[model samples]
Target: MSRRCELTGKGVMVGNNVSHANNKTKRRFLPNLNDVSLMSDTLGRTFQLRISASALRTVDHRGGLDAFLAKAKDAELSPRALKIKRDIAKAQAATAA
Candidate 1:
């Protein structure tokens, strides 16, 4: 697909590469993305996602995928991620109800 993080919404950033001669060239800084399968405690399933390294660290720090998704804003999540988030929410609600 695209060069973007499915979790953190990290994408390519554009900047100028400056040379010693004061010449500037366009450059792109891409996020460190990796394909990972994260286990969701609520859904009890493993979901594969493409996410940035930093986002993966944050997920670990936050405890797990479920916890991270709970804290993540809807605006930042991709359509696929958002669907997963909704599924988790529905599962949790059903269990609680």
Candidate 2:
């Protein structure tokens, strides 16, 4: 598996590291990811995925698990993670009021 977030689609970003002497070196900043088991209402199963911490936070902030998943679907998320995110997003929206 790659160092990518299954939920937010986070990946490695490339950049340059500069020094006071104007020296530059190639560098990369990786997203914060975690391995988690998400329950999917659509499939009625649990799937394990690697997701970014930020993506998880976005889901939590928007509403709950279900609502978060819905947002991911709208964003054209990965096929493997779609069901779980959708379920979570819906559940979140329902709980919000």
Candidate 3:
């Protein structure tokens, strides 16, 4: 898989590495991604996701995986994450009914 955050869709950023002599070199700034297993209360299951550290913190801040997914924007999420988001919504709706 590519170096990208599944939840936040954060990927490598291109930049320049400047030396002391004012020489510029190409550099890639990668997101701080971690493979984590997050448990969902509504779904009663755990999911493995490669997410960024900031996204992990955001998930915690929002309470849990369910809340984060509900509040996250579709454009910002990867295809896999978007599918998971849809599943989460379905599970929540089923539980609510």
Largest lDDT belongs to which candidate?
1
58: Cα error in model 1, Å: 0.4
**Overall lDDT per candidate, in order of appearance:** 0.94, 0.70, 0.90
Per-residue lDDT for 1-97 in model 3, tens only? 8899887888999999999999999999989989999988778889999999999999999999989989889998888778888998998788789
Candidates ranked by lDDT: 1, 3, 2
What RMSD value applies to candidate 3?
A: 1.0
Candidate 2 global Cα RMSD: 4.8
lDDT of each residue in 1-97, candidate 1, tens digit only: 9999988888999999999999999999988999999999998889999999999999999999998999999988999999999999999999999
Q: Which 10-residue span in candidate 1 carries the lowest summed lDDT? A: 1-10
List candidate 1 segments past 4 Å from native: none
Each model's Cα RMSD = 0.7, 4.8, 1.0
Report the error of model 3 at residue 86, Å. Answer: 1.2
Better of 1 and 3 by TM-score: 1
